[model samples]
Target: MNKPTLLFTAALLTAPALLALTACQPSGPVTNAPETNANSVTTLPISELPLHAEQATRLDNNLWLGVHPHGDIQIRDGQGALVGQQPVAAEFISQRRDAQGDFFLSLTTDNQLMFYRASAQGISDLHLSAELPWPLEGMCLYQPSAQELNLFVMDESAIAHQLLLTRTQGELLAREIRQFPLPPLAEYCVVDDSTDQLFVSEENIGVWSYNARAESEVLRKPVDLVKPWGALEHNTGPLAISQGQLLVAELGSDLLHAYPLDGGDTRTWQLAPIAAGQPLAADALTVSADSDKTVMAVLDDNNGKVYRAELTLPARAGDNQRIVQVAPVAETRPMRKSGDAADDPAIWVNQQQPELSRIIGTNKKYGLYVYDLAGNELQELVVGRVNNVDVRQGFSLKGQAADIAAASQRDRKAIALFSIDPLNGQVSTAGEVVTTLDNVYGLCMYRNITDNRFFVFINDQDGRFEQYEITDSSAGWRGKKVREFAVKSQPEGCAADDRQQRLFIGEEDVAVWTLSADAGAPTDMTQVAAVSDVLVADIEGMDIYRSDTEAYLVVSSQGNDSYVLYQAEAPYEYVGRFRVGINAEKGIDGASETDGLTVTSQALGADYPAGMLVVQDGRNLLPDENQNFKTISWDSIRAVVIAP
Candidate 1:
């Protein structure tokens, strides 16, 4: 039974702020309804079950399951007759029936989380499949794909845990992928896989919705509230979602509320008033619907009498936001420190042996890290606090041709340089060149295709950018400031296209601007893309993926944890956006709040035949390790966003 006492009102007195979260909008403006007669739609009790059970839910039109007083599960028909029973002991149960008529159950046994599977028609005999030692109050299952199943569990202290479950060699395994906080007294949770939405009921407050995708931000929006705040007369009770409506039961009333998942008016159903000898308490509820009819079941907590009813509801309206989802093929090792340690990544292609290529990443808190194609840490250069890094090949240093890498060393307020041996792929610190700016933040390197002259562009946090000509002489290497420019606001994460002689820079809170890569050419800036629905704010990383015939620019929309693609040529057309989702099979969590990224079109090996894109994973979850970089094959991205 739902807890009747509303003991969390003072803690949640800041209702104005919580109600303003717009990620999950309400069905519509809620109007207060009377307690005894709430826009009543009559519902008649079809049957009553005589059993001492705590909770009851409908499996199909003819079968229902409940927790009997004997600690086992009991099955009953629609006409209130006992049919079958399953002796599985469960303290709490959550059931879901997929489109294929397969039933999945999440049950809490003592402090362990267990999963059961059975056919909808044969639910009396369930197959115990998976179990994990998790002390959770409730659990809900979300299926991202046909083969990937994830469980979201609610603990006793109002915390949510997302775990990915897998099977290997007939053994089941569960691993924690992510975790987030929930409002105090959060009791019930249900997920709509079709809409990628998670609805959690706060006992003393209302129903809140969240984006169920593992890669999405943790933003909760209100669905409805209690009393003068919204529409309910008392605290919220059990919640069920079916046919696009979030069905909510009132904790201490005979009324039920149905809120359309999409925008629409709320509908209230008034159950028949209690008679002289009928069960009086409505504690648990279940709802299911098809194309033709909708059915609801309510459990009487005191006497274990089950009540069933039919509902006539309007059609469900759907306006779901759709985006492509893909997972990383590999991930680098965790950084040495936590927090925002990893900032940028640059890939170095080995011309002699593509498989021997390496990845260069900036550990802003420490120094630099070098990793091989298989994500093994090969070397570390402890220079200073480097923010962003870029790599270019074929630079003359000390009368020898070498690969050059540059990063904005914030600690030194200069440009940190490294020389990579082309033959052995070893990175050694060359030296640093102080900049005129007070603070150097972002850095990128470019080489002129016409004269093969190398240059590095460094930006300050105050929006000042200075281009320096990097030349090699007898005294190692030197940098001379050539041109200086500034944007209206802070800028970082710039990429240079050597083939097109163009440079692209992301103005953190503004738009992406393009200028000439040649130091002597005009520094006219052109707005390529602005912050919008697809391209969210705080645009961090920008890179170009160029093949022999086509090129596309990718930008990290840090505000939304998604990446937006565009045509790299003039009049850049918006292509699409995609998110790096969790790889349940490999146990690799997706990237979120990315800072800097790099991509190359040169084939590295069999794993990344069409090149790879490396992005800094700001919040690395699966095991909650330190921040690191993730590598995704370009072909995997093209298959979803660019395939025509």
Candidate 2:
């Protein structure tokens, strides 16, 4: 790898730039990235990339090569003289011949997929298609048949597999994504056009194959292809197919093994170095047919080297292709309204039956709307202007251990409390706690396991927040104000990390301030990401997603129509940020003006098996519809979190 270089290179801030949402603006110190706001992002001019051939291939009478990640992609003529070069940024690029015998390659720069077409005229830009949510490994283009070509990109984490429909395409389509499942992370993959199969090499596991088309089974299991080859614990290189044999590059051992799909014994070769005195440190591999000869190529990351050799063929391995990667999806709450109303959500996980879990959303128009993980509205409560909501399970409510939910009611200027039915996934109003603050807005739950008590922290539009404790009374549920906080401007989004005893509050036009979640605890606050820099004005919603080993804070940059993620604990390091871009598959629009968001790290159902992230969409339109809550799979967010 080209050692981690300048990341998030530039930082520019202006007053007018702060006024608009940074939906598409470059938000980081990206090296050489242009200053952008609300209009463009993920930019890299072809003239900026410097070319140094890390790998090279001879195809269509030309030499195609990829430079360093931040360097250029170059095309040279048959005489090995540079014909032309494109300052294209990419960590790696690989080429394959199309059915028409022309070559095409995928160049990945910062996880954004770029394509180049190689023909008799030389190499030309194809499309800078899919915006990968995270840095991933390997990519392939499949032509199940002529007139129907698709792009497949692998997620480096065990989160998801994506297919751009195309995230950006030619005269065919643009930015359509379909997501599917595969091994957590795939290091190498190749498409067998003859059998219409896609094979993904799962290091230490084995070679796995799947059908290239939709509706076909994907990543069922690994084919027992590597047991005879020996343990491939550090198989970080590539895999290729020529004729009936499969060529596997063992990077760790500096060896190459060819396995015949038939019953023949596997052949092994000690790979020759790209240069004298150097051993092969393969990063990628490719196999091609030159007339009756089989040619293979290897890319070395450590040495910036390229080597190619010819190989012998083996008999066909039968018709054994399975299925694999599709694009991602965007979903929203099923209920519709005449105007923007939906504000926040709270997820209740039914540990016994994952599918029975419910997503409780506050429809500011009237009350709390509950939906299944699939976005189907299950129930709605006319509780009067519920704005932001949150839930915490395993609470000792009235001496009974159950789940409790609360919301800030704007109309009543109170906190509406509900009892969650863990069994049937139903919710009913337990009671209400009228607050002293005017114009209630945001609310979150905190359960003190030490005292076995539950608390509700509610904030208002006037920048005042009160922490109240819910106690069981002989009459009904009553709340007592435990502590109070005040900020300089409007305050809305707030979340309490019961696990860490910390609370994060978003001061609309200011920044996120943190303090103790305990009653009577000192309010020594710390600023997280402030306005105009890490965040634009009106930092909206905040929630904490607790994974197995760590926790992450998810924030809605309402002013910019984007969501920012953080490490959640002290010294909250920024992970990354992403706007809920359009989901062409569902005809659903991305989110903007998000007021509140909530997350649950539990598999609610098959759709959200890893978990679900629910955010309120300020502008839920395209056909111009009213606002509602959009649900993004937490797995999608996890991909970015796990990315380098």
Candidate 3:
């Protein structure tokens, strides 16, 4: 048994003046202290940066800042001093500082807007600016008429929705000026000031553009953005705009896409590997307009930090540009290797046992592995084909021995109870398997804080979902079917927002289904967002995160190639899309069929301080392969934009 540790909570009171003073520093600027030196910086050759560039800009004269190896948004100068930085909170989506030098940040913690004034003294006067009606995922800063700064936030509320042109004075005081409804879980939006239109990228559906002036309707026909390469990865980062062209980062392949602003032609630029063996996460990316050229920054999540380089244009002189890699900055911790078959990671933060934080990962062959915050495998529980797993506390009729015994004898002769051992990584059958669920794909634990009752939601491969009650203890659980819902297609991923009493289900080649627990029975199924296009292929994994008032749904496309991220629609809106994949060259013998995904936002352990997303590379199945798992740093994963 893992011993539980005690925790105490104490409120620290400080004078408002002191609090204001610390806010001025805003986590302190990256200084060129003795800690960071040029000798410590590694500069790969320009050819190593790979991908051909349609357009490249020089942001600074000194050195080209590539992607940050670390996850933090710190753009460094040639000397390695932090030039620009943005601080993000848990569940927060995106941050930007406009050309006017005003800083805008989103708070996923509560779907609120926290603004900061950046002065020479640093970031001071932090204040809450606006309260969104619902939680948000992706956000962008646009100048509608050059007089006002319009903040557009993506909300996947009921379907896909958008908060249009919320005008804010400067960057701090933001108020809602208008709103618009969009397709479910739109990935990213780019404002074409040249045409007074906003182009939104909807994963599987295509790209739709709406007139900023006419908020009621879409202006352009939806265009298909799918590439032969496969479904794009999800949650990489923001798209880039350069010289009448939109640059989109492809998550599955090492390719940068260029879409003509006039909507005439689309082309792809493949990035070459910087090092012979180095892998690229391509999570987050930033572009800067330099005096003479355009510079781009791509974050490598597989490695810890960012890569700064120059984008080289095409040979047409105006069409071709070159991207050069320059410097790298180190983050707090080095990226760890994601475990083999480590899928669907869930965190159980014990309030009664605060220090007893445990992360349970589903391993198809090895059962569930519990790990401490330090990334040490504490124990492994043997559950067959553990596609999905969750934990909650409580008892229900479904888990009662009488129910299990009756159900076991009536249906399958097997019992349905599990026993776990923390120290020895062992699990034994506490009861027989009651009913062999047909294609059990997803699982979640629903806790009723009000009554302390726990419920389980499981998604079956046969286009149906079942609910059960837990009667036994945390380790030993018996389940009885309470309700079932049909999804039409294979239901691969499922997540529950207990606070909101909502569940998100991902269907293959269909939209995501949202079910309200408050309504009697599980039949009240509604199409919250469509995944037919957003996910490259069939949706296989899903996870929901609630930060304050907002809820985020992350769905995996096991068949296609990437993960799709959606914000709640009716109560939320489609924010943006992110892409996930192992770097192109890093693939085992250069293959790209990636399947199975699991994500967590809170730090699971010390090694994974910011949280993690684990995916399975189908290419690694070859018996001759040296390693079974490929782990990318979560920080690096959030650095680049999967699509522009």
Scored by lDDT, the top model is 1
Give the per-residue lDDT of model 2 (tens digit) for 555-593: 887655567888898898877776565555565555667
Candidate 2 residues lying further than 4 Å off, grouped into runs, are 1-118, 121-330, 396-401, 584-588
- lDDT string for model 3 (1-644, tens) is 01112121111213453334233422111111111123432332232232111111123344332221123323344555555444533222233445556453445354556555433343444556555676664565554332334567777662223332233343445444345455564656666454445656655433444544312222333322332212232321236665555556644334455556544445544455656765455544556555444466565545534455555433222422111111111101111222334445555453343334554555554555566433456665554545555544333332342211111111232223443333322334455334446656656656666666556666556776667655565445556667677777676667667777787777767777887753255477787776554555566666665555445676665543345567754644655544332121221111123334445555544544545555444333212231122333344444432222
> Model 1 Cα displacement at 375 (Å)?
1.9
Highest TM-score: give the candidate number: 1
What lDDT does candidate 2 reach at residue 441? Answer: 80
What lDDT does candidate 3 reach at residue 530? 66
What lDDT does the true structure give each of the candidates?
A: 0.77, 0.65, 0.45
Cα TM-score per model? 0.87, 0.53, 0.42
**Model 1 lDDT per residue over 283-360, tens place:** 777666756567767776565566777777776555345666778989999999877799999988899999899999
Better of 2 and 3 by lDDT: 2
